[model samples]
Target: MSPPSQFSSLPKDLEWLILARVPKRLYPILACVSKNLLSLVRSPEIHKTRSSLGKDSVYICFMHKNDDGVGHTSHWFTLRRTKNNPSTEENQLVSVDDLTFPDHAEPMPSIIACGPEIFFISGSYVPSSTVWIFDSRTDEFRRGPSMNVEHSFKCVGLVGSKIYVVGGYRNDKIHQAESFDLKTQTWELTPSPDEERLAFSTANVSLDRKVCGFMYLAAITICYDPRDGSCEVFDLPKDRWWETGVCVMDNVLYVYYARLGLMWYDTELGLWRVVNGLDDMKKVRSVAMGEYYGKMAFLWEDSACVGCAMKEVWCRMIGLVRSEEGGIVGNAEPAQLMGSVPSGYRLQHCLSVSE
Candidate 1:
């Protein structure tokens, strides 16, 4: 006869409750204990329970230049609680060796994380309508529905259940925008913005349920409302031309300006406000920001080194709170050395996936 189940005595609901309370990092070990536990750990019901209880976990994935500097490689790492000191919540970035990205021609594909999945949109010298999705929970890669229009040098934004792909080159013309519906598992064309506005955009983000494409060179931002298919263009502040280090957390857009420190866009005031409490923070040569379980996962490189030498990558978790005065405040921890990479490896992107 088979061994008696470990959770045989507990009720089904009680078993789920107990597992939901456990740290997600421990789920792998729990899965190994029994086949039933393995199935439970990978079930959507368990993830829903954990998410509703506010027990979501964030994992950071980023890309850097390969050691030889010919191409780029992606890596996944998550903040795991220290084993030596279980009492404290001190965590460190441990590489997730099981999760791997497939080889693609694009040096850096536009990537965004929604829940446990990360979508990588295609962008290369040759226009292609391919998309690859990486599932953090299962550590697997699957091809998503391709975009309707082929594009190169594109920008992507995630709003609700849809991912908007905008602004790229196709047949020597600016490709029209398209969106992929996660729920329906299909792609549809979104109304195109001005050809000139679409061509020069370098980055895009979802804000206020709309997709905003940023063109730093022209100091212009095009806002596209997927609901109404309307587009609006506005000029950015003179000093806010550099927007490569931008991310959204809790419906608020945050940008890291090397000369000015961290700032957030005030939707009501239509201006950028300084995120108080980070005044003493030192500026870095390059930085990337992501939402880390309601906090900001900030990563940066101190040196402006070039070529194949090794350099250190630093990280800090900043907690954000709203002030009574209608401003945002940041409580940042001391910087920690996350890992090292080749000097030629620029921190292309940083995204946090919740499981």
Candidate 2:
């Protein structure tokens, strides 16, 4: 007979509470304990319990340049709470996990999250129109169907279960939008935008859990909705088209205007305004923004001199509060140093995911 099991005698409710607190990386070990334990670890209720109890761990996905600065490598690091300083809830990035990404994924990989899975679409330097889907639960990578056309510096959006890819550099003059069905693993061309654009800067979320892909076209910001096939245009206020950083939180689009502080756009009202805080970030470099722990967070590198190429990168979490007069204002906390990267390595992108 098999050795007596420790968790076997525990009540199911107590078992869930205990296993839910375990790190996601150790789920495989727990699954081997017993069939009942494996069921608990894989159950949807276990993750829901962790999320409801504020125990969800946040993972940051990014890529680092190789030694020669000619190649890029992708990785995932968990921002875990420090055990030595357990009093505060501050998070520090740990080492990279065992999860592997597509070989030679571009320095900037276009990605989208659908449920517990993350789809890594083609990047700027990648040639093939292939897509890689990552299952966070299983911690495995699987190749998905390829797109009809190769895209670089394009925008990707997720609506319901399908993924939409917008304008990018392509040889074909059609310049049409293409979407992939997650269930069917098939690609189909969608309605094309009026303008035959060449490139897009960034894609962000816009309203009510919907993905609104944003791209800087000429001097205008094109907000494309994949669900309804609608597009909205917003005029930019600066000439630094390529230097701007954009992210979305609470249904508002936050655009980090180059050297002009952060600006916000309300898609519903079609209004733009300069945010109150974060005016001092004008000198920051390589700024990237994302949503973190129910707040808007940004990661950026400090300005560096010619001889000093490697600079310390910092992350700050900002809270947005609505004024009684209907204006949106931002308040920020102290910036936390996220460690420094070498001269050849660059902080390509930063995204926050809860598990």
Candidate 3:
């Protein structure tokens, strides 16, 4: 076999390797030189083969300010992991408006969530908040039933198949959080018992993953003991909010997280100590869930912002000490998976968000 002859000239596989190693800027030149190269780069098969998982990645939405009073679909963009490392505008964003259902009607991106095979985004420039289901694979967004309430919607999210909505206001005294179940096609509105405590802005950011404590308390892992108002917990396995722990500032459980094993808030003693080891963080925005080198942990975005504001987001990686289920980290997911600006592509000395 004599070492396969001259490596570079001997085979087509070697040619692809040579081309792959070449600077990407040279790709345009490569394509220009031959029609075959152009077809290869444009091949849909190439993209399909690269990833067969369907598009399960989380997509973030922003209210893109535009010339029109109601923004156009073209302004709505989605970011995903890319091999090219996201530099150019094309790499940074993929317009999902076109992928929406084949209706010429306007697309108001709202109520974004990552379901198993779809990202549900619904909103309306009109008084009614319309729900839209987007199929990432088909890139089509289909309009669903319109919300009955008239005021306008502030926030929306989902736990499993149930969609929860908390609002801005219809009139006065309409303080409520509405729950809609897609599986049953049933819509139920509950006068938000907690409306007095959380205002409109709070409701708008209500679904924001940060402010909620993710320990064993409220909704995700273990049942939260609502007996103590101090904290909010989600038992993930059961997929419901529980009343286990309470809130805490310092050692006082200003917020309770039962799963993290937080039991008490020493406001009377006025001291703060982890009655349970879950006393890591009091708040967070978005989180990433995965095993880091077989150890579960979290990466997060401290604040929530729309558009490609990863440049504005504060990205942090927290090493979580895993329990039986998964690791926890606050402000974690969006920043690492989709938000942060790519190295060398984004300038380091960007100005502060407020500035």
Top lDDT hit: 1
Please write out the lDDT profile of model 2 over residues 28-109, one tens digit for every residue: 5667777877787766567545644545444555566676868667656555455575335475766556556665545566
- What would the TM-score be for candidate 2 when compared with the true structure? 0.70
**Model 3 whole-model lDDT (C-alpha atoms):** 0.35
Misplaced by over 4 Å in model 1 are 1-71, 83-88, 97-100, 240-244, 304-308
For model 1, residues 16-125, the per-residue Cα lDDT tens digits are 77778776545656777788888777665664465455454446555676768687677667654455753343556677896566745766677777767888787765
- List the RMSD of every prediction in angstroms: 8.7, 9.0, 16.6
**Poorest lDDT segment (10 consecutive residues) of candidate 2:** 204-213
**TM-score to true structure, per model:** 0.76, 0.70, 0.41
- Candidate with top TM-score is 1
Global lDDT of each candidate: 0.71, 0.64, 0.35
